[model samples]
Target: MTDFISLRNISKCYSAAGRSVFALKDLSLDIRENEFLAVVGRSGSGKTTLLRILASLEEPTAGEMRFRGKLCSPGNPLPSGMVFQDARLMPWLSALENIIFAFPPRERTAELHEAAKKMLETVGLSGCERSMPRELSGGMAQRVALGRALIKNPSVILLDEPLGALDYFTRRAMQRELIRIYLQEKKSFIMVTHDVGEALRMGTRVIVLGEGQMRKEINVDFSYPRPRSDPRFQRLIDEVLDAIGDGE
Candidate 1:
């Protein structure tokens, strides 16, 4: 696999209450193309901080991040789009408009509408283009959010707990949707999810972090639509739980 993103000795620290708080410490990892990398860890493990640093939303206090052999900057950031836990859609915008808003306002045109419409279809929201955020269910709203990210045709997509808000059934359905999108789009997707089972179900490789450090990296060799009842699947979950020191 070709390396898409590489982080070398990445560290992030902040001063809070006269104490130096380190979210990440001397961390290094490589994300390859077309890989679904799930990041799992306990609270304060710096999972979200890692994602934000990669997204260029936060500046790392130390270390370097390179994308495809080039240094990354705010202007020449990683070739990716991001989705948050909440759909974060514009309240007044239609689903299609929400997708279109991902592009710059200066770049908005009739052509972008057709592009958004196509992405809406791609994300299984074919008939809901005109639906406002108020009219859409939680799952449907997230679908719109996913559309916004995918519409950018990014080489990588960063998701920070993108499905944590949905109902159990809706979350399961969206999990399948995520796998389907990953396979169809073949983009490098790094998702930071608290749900261990969700990570095992979706990721090609799972990275476990603890106390601001990488604790484990496990490769899920199982195919999509993996059976949790299978012994291998359950073992993987156990391994991840153990990594987070929450074996259960």
Candidate 2:
């Protein structure tokens, strides 16, 4: 099977205050089709930069990126949808409208509306569609953002700390919801997160970034609904943390 996403010796640098700073260093990775891959790392570890490169939101100073065997060039349209850390919704628009904003105005408007409604329901935000972003809770707004992404029906989804702002309970719930969506939709998911447990719970493979490089890759061979207290899970977390030089 062809790899859904491939990054070959990718590197990125930025000029700041007349000096060049490297954000990524010769990074290479492959994400298989229909796989849920989580990228975990400390602040400034290049996790977000990696996602941006994969999504074509940012350009790499060196190397190549491809999606589904096609070369990814600058300004190349992303084959995937994205959900950021913030909901990034149009505060002026209702939840439904924000979702519909991406759809082209054509004869299929009604069909798109129905599709958006179903996506909202899939994300467990059924009755709240008519509410504006200001009226909705943070979790609800994020759910709407997720719904918007899913409504695109892209082959891949890039999540940049999408659940980071939620409270513990909501975050846990969203983790389960993400897994369900991945299983039901069978779409490729690549997520950047700092939460180790979240990565372990939702990702079939976890890639650890550290010091501007891909440091480690781990596979969670265990089944879904993995227990945090499970000895193997805790052991894997410790190993990852240690790999990143985090003692705790």
Which pairs of residues collide in model 1?
none
Please list the residue runs of candidate 1 whose C-alpha ends up more than 4 Å from where it truly belongs after superposition. none
TM-score of every candidate relative to the true structure: 0.97, 0.95
lDDT agreement with native, every candidate? 0.93, 0.87
Kindly provide the TM-score of model 1 when superposed on the true structure, using C-alpha atoms: 0.97
Tens-place lDDT per residue, model 1, 1-248, is: 34568998999999999999999999999998899999999989999999999999998999988999898988889878899999999998999999998999886777898999999999999999889999999999999999999998988899999999989999999999999999999899999999999999999999999988999999999898888898999999999999999886
In candidate 2, stretches whose alpha carbon ends up further than 4 angstroms from where it belongs are 104-108
lDDT, model 1: 0.93
What's the TM for model 2? Answer: 0.95
Query: Cα deviation in Å at residue 233, candidate 2?
Result: 0.3
Residue 60 lDDT in model 2?
91
